[model samples]
Target: MASMNDHPGERAAADPVKLIGVRETPLSVDEVFRAVGDDAAGGTVLFVGTVRDHDGGSSVDRLGYSCHPSAEAELRRVAEKVAANHPVRALAAVHRVGDLEIGDLAVVVAVSCPHRAEAFAACRALIDDLKREVPIWKHQTFSDGTEEWVGAC
Candidate 1:
């Protein structure tokens, strides 16, 4: 198998940030980490948000996500902000939509910087901004047959 170090876009995909749209398929944490993995980067930070079995004491059985077309545009804007604010060598943010079972990955954000402090700061900011700004909604179904539509909750 090809390692993440040998990612196809290593040479040409040199943009400081990358954003992707994928089906409700599984994501590779290692791949996101490696996308920003560079010798010049001293630190890499990543955030993975997973679908949980419960939310606010409600037992969640499954979730469905839908996004506005503007989601992709917003994600790119977030990545751009990170690159501008920090000495980010590379960054990527990916969010999966459609039906998802418990424990499935909902989103992943990764960032690499010249130092650990900057990487951590940038990663945190990216995730926070995304949760607040991204035009995505989650429809959660509970085990008790109750369902709720939450806007980025």
Candidate 2:
């Protein structure tokens, strides 16, 4: 057990939550992965979501992401909830917004735990909840020049 005199965040550091949001800039998977690296963690799982060239079998020209002002706050809330529910040693998540090209990373998340199963489960929950809970919208431009918006709060 860590003593109180240790790092102020040590005791609670088992669940370090890091939420990095890039509104107009590019998202860094390396940064997100590094944020969740912990010495005590026996396993770490990382998930990187990218923008593909097609969606629903339709050729997609490009895609864009937009977020509400409360997106970051909501992200933190979701991360906190996941950490509280799981034995998370560390957690990190980053989402990219603005115009994006095919093969661009739209989101990256990672979680560390004392065991491999725990790390996989916790990492899954982190990304699943983030995509559902965050007030982020996706704008897609199809090859037919049609556009559609999905998932906005």
Best by lDDT: 2
Q: Write the per-residue lDDT of candidate 1 for residues 110-130, one digit (tens) a residue.
A: 988777998899899999988
The digit string of per-residue lDDT tens for model 2 on 28-49 reads: 8788888988887788899999
In candidate 2, which residue ranges exceed 4 Å CA deviation?
1-15
The best candidate in terms of TM-score = 2
lDDT of 1 at 58: 89
lDDT of 2: 0.85
